[model samples]
Target: MKEDSVLKKLSRDWRVVLMVALVIFSVIAIGPHFDENGQFATNLQYGLDLQEGSWLQMEFQAEVVTVQTGQPLQEIAANLSEQLDAEVLPVGPDQIEVRMPMTEAELRPLFEQAGAEVVAVNQGVSKETAESVKRVLDEKVNSLGTKDARVNVLTGLNGITRYVRVELAGVDMETANEIVGKQGKFEIRVETTGDQTQHVLFGDSITSVSTPEKDPHYGKWGVSFTIDEAGAKAFQEAAISSNAVNDPQNHELIMYLDNETVYSAPLTVELANSLKANPVRSLTATTGTGDEGLEKAMNLEIHLRAGSLPVDVKVVGSGSVSAALGDYFKILSFLAAVLALIVVGVVIYYRYREPSIVLPMVMTTLAEILILLGIARFIQQLDLASIAGIIAVMGTGIDQLVVITDEVLHEGRVPSPSVYLKRLGRALGIIMVAASTTIIAMLPLALMDLSTLRGFAIITILGVFVGVLITRPAYGKIIMAILSK
Candidate 1:
């Protein structure tokens, strides 16, 4: 009868029930299981410092400039490109991107000569260009069949992105460097008779590559690209010399990247005739129609760029961690967490001198940490900094539990149920205020890309939320049941 009453009581309390459900769900999400080698493991991922990996930080060698001009923006950009001997693109109505590194002082004179004034100059690429660079890097890394990689564009508050960082797990520093530094060599060749081919131009001759789009009239997916004047003339000459204009079926154009043929198609009748009369600067390579065509066209676009960034990048920093060292760090992290919990339990026991109070407090805190880890398994990878945050959370959690225990056990004895309820409310109010302050303090660190601190801030914030919303309230109800008994 007493066991039944206890079960009924637990069922009556929604807080206790919710906590029980969450704990079960957390255990499942963690997915602890035996590996093929009969070793115990969970679905938890570790970051660079806690796993074998290599990291690289690269700085973009480009500039974003604010300009004031009376002439048309395109005309000013063209003139500036000519004088500076570099690529210039308009990013906004007043903001232009200079592909080459230049200081404000150096750019001012050039802007004036081009009928424009340099209002401001920042040493980085614009946000759009930075995103493009990130995309290209992501594609390059994924092409290597790397399962674990992270690419981040670090942007400043002024909207200029200055650096990009890449982290790859299970890779050595040398291989990582080679992957980032390598560039694909793209070439176009015209087929003469049989298997004979003549070189037309290289990737350097290509000025720009556009995203894949469908031709509305033909319902075909293709990427459009523009070539320089010299490339256009060379392409026209190659076509005429190969007699591709008159015998389109017999002659074909092949595109190669790194000496491997990626695309081969006979020139269209219209394109052949046009090349005979004039040099074509703009050309389209159609993949085909429907979803498969769109996918192929996207790949072709990446091939056209040849793994090149719009802005140049210089490796600013590089590092690697060996697997043995990473194992040591992981062991240290686990020891730290265990040591922290032991310390908290000892300190709380010294204050209360009661096993009931100390055990529940420690167990509740552990539950909070478990839920945090379970959620992080899906969203984040644990690192040294995040582990530190978890330890800090344990400390804070014990403090809050102390507040609750002292409040409810006022006058050294369990109070009436009504008084216990009032004290619990007051204790929760205190916890809410403290949690809000901690969250607010960590907000900037979490939101801003402060490098390593970002992970710490985010983990701390998540811990606080889990404690306040889940474990703390459940602890309160469980303590009430224990004390009333």
Candidate 2:
């Protein structure tokens, strides 16, 4: 084939190869979501570890309830703390509560352990039933869009009930506080595009929402929404208003929340219960699948986008990335990376006794860094920790590259390339163990509830593995050829 034809062929077919590789990579990156009850895909989630020190904050809210019979305030407070799995502090002798760093999932079990119930009136509960209080708490916790959060309990004044406090971290403070304010109230409003129109849609009917193509042809993205019965009624009414508008220009309804535009478009076909009849079905996986599995995910993603809370966010407590701090961190990181390169470079010189070998090691080291930065931007966000990790891996790669380089350049006097690789494999086995140990030690922390720490651990582990697996080998191979010349 002509070089142009070959290039075109590669360009044409590269997507297939990339797709397959990406699918595998995505599975490694986001597949863990499928194993969870939520069926979440981590594909789009920027792990905090990857972007550590970007922004972080924690906010606290307090929930009040009545005291039940048979428990003193102090005991009840203590009990509530245990239920919430947080430390309770006595705000007052007769009333007290607590706060802990527990996530949302840990609350109910803690409540059950405390033998307290969630009461409605915020008043006295008979000494009789602690189960109700816990059930209420459990219900509320489950209803919130989170499975992880912090909770605590306190005694109420006048023997009214327990006061509970929840602490949320790793989210913007404004949004988090708004979420707490909502108390998990599922609110939906159906409204037409204009005050003159009489159509609407409700929250319950929304089976899902999709932007389908990340970007649309019109320069404006289109979104599809599925409605349940209650939502269908509201949507139909809103559509009817659109139909009522005699002016073609007015023949559309808009969706709004808190007096702000969310979705607005012309009302076309009306559907009965099922969204498959809707014209935009082709773009939506959730609508066409008939699988309820996607419904919750769609709802969650939609609610985050359409609701008050943002699906993506800015760091809550990233008060100021001190130009001073950034400067300091950059200097240290640069020093460390340079120091590593120098050490590796010196080692290669000591081992190979030639400038040819040393030069390639330096090139391979720089190449690894470029590849790491590219991966961080496209595949994930890069933070200081991950940068540190990448630098460390680069240093490690130099040593391995030196081995492979040494092996390859000597093949004429030694064995063949494959034979040299075989000899190199023994050392690689040791390298693999070292890399594996680092990755294994990081697994638990990578899986931590602390998103930043999780990102740090994950990216670092991946960086080390990538250095050892993909980049190191290729770099070493290329470096070996150059050195042999």
Q: Which candidate is the best by TM-score?
A: 1
Q: After superposition, how far is residue 121 of candidate 2 from its true place, in Å?
A: 19
**Candidate 2 lDDT, 265-329, residue by residue in tens:** 44333332233333222222222223343343344344423442211122223232434454566
Give the TM-scores of the predictions, in the order they appear.
Answer: 0.80, 0.46
Best by lDDT: 1
Q: Model 1 lDDT vs. the true structure?
A: 0.88
Clashes of each: 0, 34
Q: For model 2, what is the alpha-carbon lDDT of residue 468?
A: 77
The global C-alpha lDDT for each of the candidates, from Candidate 1 onward, is 0.88, 0.47
Q: What's the true lDDT of residue 86 in model 1?
A: 79
- What TM-score does structure 1 among the candidates reach? 0.80
